[model samples]
Target: MRGIGYSLLAAVGAWAFWPTLRDLAEKWQHDPQYSHGLLVPFFVAYLIHRKREDLKQISAVPSWPLSLLFLSTALGCRATSAIFDFLPLDGLALILVLAGAVSLIQGKEMLKTVAPALGFLLFALPLPYSMERWLSQDLQHLATLASTYLLQAIGQPAINEGNVILIDEIKLGIVEACSGLRMLMTFAAFATGITLLIDRSWATKTVLILSAIPIALIVNVLRISATGLAYVLLREAPERQNMLGFIHDFNGWMMMPVALVLFGIELKVLQWLLVEPEKLERVISFPIRREMPEVPARKAA
Candidate 1:
């Protein structure tokens, strides 16, 4: 009965989260690049289950003032979203959801324990519509330039028009969808999840997450470059423009695999670049302890 009261109160207090969840739906409907949006609730459920053991161990501390602060910030974000709609990154929404969940389950300390993992999950959210448009243009152009240069590098005749690359009379428009940003987003999302799962320090996670972005872009460029080679070297006539159509028709499915391969490369590179945290701690703390004067041991209270 006592447990029931606590659980019921938590449910009632978590009501403030409805707005954020609705906002997520609104965003998902707008410019969805993948079907992963449908999986978000499941993902959240999985995270909760994954941490179920830890949650059982944690004793929640209710702080009304801190919770109200978080609530106000969420409201402020919703209001800011009303006017500008680009006030926060999609990740911030996940943070808000986690905040409410933590308020219901525990508090700052327990929340912090899994903050990196939750923050990493936020990568699954799509980019804001405004930013996505800008990125799409840049990626399209990059794909075009890379494709043209590669064709010419192999001594093939090539002409570039904006994002449209013409080779051996076959034209390939590195269309909006083909810009590879979609693949990049998908790969980066998973990479973030993996990084958080393994690495603990914020610095290491941040570096890995940031690295995911550029690595995705480069892998995308490579995919485009490969497709361009096939179009130019294989096609014998100008009428064979279905190069892209054939490759992406259901070959769009191939992209997930390609992106995953790229993500693996990123994981390897990061693992090599990173020294283990235990080693780092030893390096930093060893000198400090040796240099500082030791205090006498204190009696237990």
Candidate 2:
């Protein structure tokens, strides 16, 4: 009976927000920068699944007041969207309705338990155009400045003007697309997911999350530096163009993997720094029998 009611609530939600979902889907499909939005729903589902054991321990009690509150908020947002023709409001209303459905079925305790994952869903929503543009411009300049200095440090003649890096005769422009904003967003989201899954202290989790910024900057620096080197070495226009194109695409795709590796290193460094020397030695000596516990003589002997 509960399952039936949940299904009916889900059906109603689908009917109410189909247009919003469709619009969001179109954005996810058409916007390359926001393509990662497609995976956020799956990530949310996975997080909830990971908490199933905790969820099973509680009995769901419906809260009429909470449900009504959420429903009213959703209706208000829908009305606002209709008045302003602002589609993002409709999407916001859909999210509110989802919260209301949980309240209707599983109550406020379950909502609290699931709120972090639900909050994460906001990352799936695209930022306002003005904000995105400002961030992208800042990132582009930072990348160009870092790449120019790094290239010159290695004895390459490089100059940066705005977001373009000139190494010898080749000019590499760090456009908005290559501004590393994508990597920053994707890796920050990835870090949040990883931090949730790990059984670590809040401080450690904070470190892991904060480390994404430096990791992203370092990775972007390396990517641009490599581009500079490739341009200098590949003097032929055809060869340089081919190599630059490959480098751009390859580095763009590999940022996430590089972020994972860097985050793992940060965790290891944190452990090494915080743990005692004996514990660290034991970890280093694992499987070598050096730290094995001594056994007492047998009673019969």
Candidate 3:
């Protein structure tokens, strides 16, 4: 009965937020980097199978007691949003509560473990115009500094604007849309989801999530460098008209795969280092010899 009440409430909440979610997705499709940033989520599903053994241990009829925590949290967030006037924080909280409650009542450990994917799904939805611009501007500043160092490493003369990377002969400006922060958000979401799904240890999950920030930074740097290289090479040739576009799309596709592979290696290393099978209990208590009744001497046998 408790679960049924939560479900009906969630259904109402979801219906209320459906239009907002649709609009966000519709806008996200317009940005290629964000569109490609979605690949990590698609890859996350591939890793879920790795935990099937442990998942089998989880019960089918979840403990409904767990739902109370999420429902309260979700309601609190929504109430806060209604009073304070914010977009989507309430929606996100509501989703978390609903999903978590359902998982408690129905899903085994495998499904319940993936609360982070809900975050990733939220990232796919579009941000408001003001928030998007603010983030884009900040990320552009970060990308500019990163790319400048990269250009210097390769003996290229470069200059930086607020978000532009100027090569000797051409400019690589961060358009309002190509801000790499979205990729960072996307991967943070992905890392959270995947680690929770396959990783049994809390420590491994922690490392996996912490690693995403640096990984995002590295990938963003590499992307910026690749663009600069393409521009420099193209300027030298002055003939391959469409080559830069190819570089743009190809780099976007490749960076994500490499990051995923590197994360897998990290997971393996963590597993090897941290996990130890439980050994027979060495410190288990035993009765004091004097306190125990002695067996009748073997004479009876």
Tens digits of per-residue lDDT, candidate 1, 1-301, equal 9689868765764574455556666755675564455565566567667777887787878656666676677667666666775534424644665576666457766776666556555654667677889988888888778767877887878889888888766777788987877766766676666654574566667776677666666666666766777665656756566664576444556656766776667667766787778877898888543567888999999
Q: Rank the candidates by TM-score, best first.
A: 2, 1, 3
lDDT of predicted model 1: 0.67
Winner by lDDT: 2
Supply every candidate's count of residue pairs whose N, Cα or C atoms clash at under 3 angstroms: 0, 0, 0
Following a full C-alpha superposition, what root-mean-square deviation does model 2 have from the true structure? 6.2
What is the Cα-based lDDT of residue 90 in candidate 1?
A: 29
Q: How many backbone clashes does candidate 1 have?
A: 0
Q: TM-score for every candidate vs. truth?
A: 0.73, 0.85, 0.66
Candidate of highest TM-score: 2
lDDT of 2 at 211: 78
Q: Which lDDT tens digits does candidate 2 get at residues 187-260?
A: 78888888878876677788888877888888988888887787778777676667778977887777778777
Model 2 TM-score? 0.85
